[model samples]
Target chain A: MRWKHSDYTGWGRVHRASGELARPERAAALSELTKDETAPAIGMRRSYGDACLNDNGRAIDMSRLDRVLEFDPDSGVIHVEAGAQIGHLLKTFAPKSWLPPVLPGTGFATVGGCIAMDVHGKNHHGAGSFGQHVTEITLVTPKGEQIVTPKKHPELFKATIGGLGQTGPILSARFPLLKAKGDVMVVTERRVADWESFIGLLDTSEATYSVGWIDATARGAALGRGILEEAETGGGLVKPAKRGKKIPLNAPGFALAPPVVRAFNATYWRRVPDRGRTSVKPIDDFFFPLDKIHDWNKLYGKNGFHQFQCVVPLSSVDALRAILEKIANSGLASPLAVLKRMGPGRGGYMSFPMEGYTLAVDFPNKARAEQVIRELENMTVAADGRVYLAKDALASAANIRAMYPEHDKWLSAVTKADPDRAYETDLTRRLKLRDPA
Target chain B: MTPTWIILGATSTIARAFARLVAERGENLLLAGRDMAELNRTAADCINHGAPSAEAIAFDARDMASFAPILDKATATEGAINVAVFVGSMPTQDEIDGDPALIAGTITDSFTGPAQFLTLLAPLMEDRGKGAVVGVGSVAGDRGRLGNYVYGASKAGFHTYLSGLRNRLGRSGVHVVTVKPGTVDTAMTWGMDGLPFLAQPDKIASDIMRAVDKKKNVIYTPFIWWPVMTVIKSIPEAIFKKLKI
Candidate 1:
């Protein structure tokens, strides 16, 4: 067994075992790693934090192994290597004007990694999570690495989905894809004043395929409440542009000030009419616009950035209000804050989806900013919600433990899967995603 | 006469690109990470990009005691650690699952180990009269999150250490830059979700280098994160302990 860890952060930032790192494209890379007494599936480096690192044990970077093994246009089902990134797959289907029912903000993430996190998206209010769309997962378990699907091993299946790679290495996944209405999305952005209005807006809309918000300036009344957006692609009304037409590469890390982002938000809002019509085109504009840029993440500049996302119930809308007020009153205007209404959810131990509204905020590394985040986490917990671990860069173990009460069960399950604790990554070690299963 | 940079965590997707970016502008470099073989591979890659002499060093961020030896060997040729950057750490994503001590160890390795290493190297730079040490700190240190407080605390301590060092060493000719990269696409937040403006490591590394050169004390990768964080911090605990984000 061999290990190699590489991320999109850059080639030099990646880690690899000189002795290992087989071209997974030739064969299943994760299979080689799982062969080790302890190994976990490796996906593309789109994860926001350290949940994928297997450390010295073994890591199977799935990037090279990425391939669409099979796709059923009729049933909207596809099976791909655990390493296949969403973007690669999108290219294959979006041209035919089809897309994954649910997707994370980052398109570079792998399907297997998405399921492991049970990723939720802007359309979560209408769609459940990534796990909901997943019909089966081909996993490499300690029990001789069998192909376990929801029907085959329901317990392991549920555990594996949103299991944080603790249950086993997912070799491949089967999911139901959706036909894109068109390649473009008809999105409308409406500004909100407070959490109540944001929640109220969600109650009214959000069934429109996609939903999001930007907590810009995080200012007074509009603190947590910023820009509320709802979008849906046209029903095949517009055609997608050429797939091969490459978008220009990303520019350097210039600062995104409140004025700039706020202007962007304002312009975006202006461009978007006030909920007068229903229309759409090009999934790129709607689903993963920034993805078109090679190094889009650079907008944050070099100091880098951290993204914190969490889900809280509609019942806790008041708590949401508190978050917004605090941010605004803090005088630390956020450039972006998003709000979304969610639908029925599938419960996974480490998954971030639940019945309610999810809010995602991006803050630069400011000493005072962290204080606001701590306060936000406490409020989210009090509201009976948990922080999204995948997007989190700085969550505390105690908070994670408390938020995910089933954490112990997940740990025990991981322990049982590999008693020697052979499979351990930086993420597992950090979040204690190490299930003592 | 371009300055050559060698990063131990080179080949870390971000680090590799960063090395190349710097080297491309005529800076010579030696990129190194876990894979010594891959380290050389990245070095050769930089050479292709315009780095006159990009190379690799086999060093580990986890081992505290061994850093000095590695630095000793490294400085033997380089003379001093000019722009030393570290992005390697056992990033904790899961909650404390099994042993408390084990979790502590992760924090110790991620935080204390780096802190101690910096402590060891600080004087060296001060004596030499010019150097920079940049670290990636997390917003998790602000207070504590319901999801990852321990890791956050460790970063907090690390940030503090950098702060203290920055204050003390500024006059001594050694510049300590603490970079608070928000959410980045590294191996750190695997399986986590709903990232807004999540950063990429290469950009982060580049940003850190720019900040180091510009002599910025603390940098929030994305500047907006700064004001955003300020608002989050100003939240009074009375209400802070209760609201959900």
Candidate 2:
């Protein structure tokens, strides 16, 4: 197989790498490539950081090998190649009253990416992380093709999920599908007046899917003000969605300026009536709202942006508030900000979920914003919270070690799987995850 | 009546995408290819995607013995039997230059072998009095160039054969779509440099589906290839030979 010399970046575009990449379309081809030259496998590059990048080295692009291997309607179990997109599965199976057990904010996240990060969804509080539903995984290492399951190789399975492709290149995975009523979502949107109401609404909500869009720019009395959305799968016929529009090019520097973002957030928060409103939408609209506008990241311009996502424990709400206050006063926050409540359901040693409230806020890749993000990370550590590796382009190795208590276990397992450090990616090297302090 | 598509080279990226599209429409499938294991995996995928029934059968372009079993199975299926030929081989120009004997194998895989199998299957479609045959050719066939001329020539021959086949089958209610994709991002063109407007395999498959739906005689995928190929074909041979593109 021939490798193409190319430059690639994660969804955040804050970090980039120039490397030789090979995209194999068949399982056999993938095996051969990995055997010849051990390298990390990448899919969709949806992780908003350097986790998927390997600078000055070789990597394998797994997107071309996407295919469904098996499905049993009786048991609602399906096997799929690692590169298959979550959205594609939802699109194909939703009409048949089936859906993936867990879906991240973006449906474009590939199965491999979901497993590597052990991603969560709005329904995480109820459904757990993506890896919890996985029955088995086919990993292609330099050694050979190894089929490991939760039962057959529990240690390896845990290490592989949230292991960030250090164990091997995930070729395929089998997971149980969640049954759904239909392909549309019935969503209830309500206005959260302040931080207290926002957390209150999330605490009391019984819906299967819930998420909050926090306005990081809101200050003082309106701090933490946002829109809370709760949704459940429902059956109904609605008008077909118009073709989604695309962002043709990067917007000017002032497009996401502070004043404009503040005004936009206020308008968006009030779009629902004072009493709140309920509406029906196609499943994709609810699950991957930003996907409709392809390359919407360009809205931040060529410099790109950084997403700082951290989860703080329930008892540490004050620390979380302090972090938000820092962000609000910094004036570096962008329009894209999200807050969610997570349950104590995680699959792997390094999985990000915890019984806490998680906040993810995006900022333009400016020096001041990076400094603010560093301060937030420190506060999170002080609060005994953890920052998500999938969204971190800026975090110190010491801080990350403090965040993930199971670092020793993950490090040992990954070392045994890849002793040569062949699969180490940009994120791993920068954070020194594979080595002891 | 549901169409049962017999896809040659079932494991090819474009073929796999096409099978999914047909499966979503609740069609039946008989996937034929050399790699039975790979083909079987795709067959199962098609079934899960929504095909009424799907089975994998062994097929070898160089071996004629594999043809009869596939023909018999497709004939037994109770529906309009459509055939899509995505079977072709392209060795690098340098490799062919090194071993002239490789030329014969290339021609057999790209032209004579698929044409022979299609010739046998034509009668079944003619007897049924309704079906479609999608022959995947390439824009490289439009004019012989410095790179991959032998493979291009074979496709050119296949294109002519498809034209004649279309003329013969049109009266019998069978439609034929000749697809000439410029540069599809498949295993075949994975790392080739200087490829313009390289389209994904799914995009090319969707274009083929649209052409087959409209019963178009000939098409260039991405539509832009139509004008681009026109310019390439119209270029003066003497000057074109000196200019490396």
Which candidate comes out best when scored by TM-score? 2
**lDDT tens digits by residue: candidate 2, A1-437:** 88999989999888999999999987888888887899999999989899999999999999977788999999999999999999999999999889999999898889999999999999999999999999899999877899999898888889998889899899999999999989899999988889989988888999999999998999999999999999999998987576568888888999999899988888888888889999999998999999888888889988899999999999998899899999999998987889999989899989999999999999998999889999999999999999999999999999999999988998888888889999999999999999965
TM-score of each predicted structure versus truth:
0.58, 0.98
Number of clashes found in candidate 1: 99
Residue A287 displacement (Å), model 1: 0.7
Question: Model 1 scores what on Cα lDDT?
Answer: 0.65
In model 1 chain B, which range of ten residues has the least summed lDDT? B86-95
Q: Write the per-residue lDDT of candidate 1 for residues B1-245, one digit (tens) a residue.
A: 34445465665556655775675576767564556755664565466445666667665666665576556744554443555555445434453644466566767655776676677767767776666777767776776766667777788888898899888888888788888877776544544567667876667878877997798999988676788778888999888788764
Residue A102 alpha-carbon offset, candidate 1, angstroms? 1.4
Q: Give one digit per residue, the lDDT tens place, for model 1 in A198-273.
A: 6677788835565656555545555454556667665455656544334243323335665676666566544545
RMSD of each: 19.2, 1.2
Worst 10 residues of 2 chain B by lDDT: B35-44
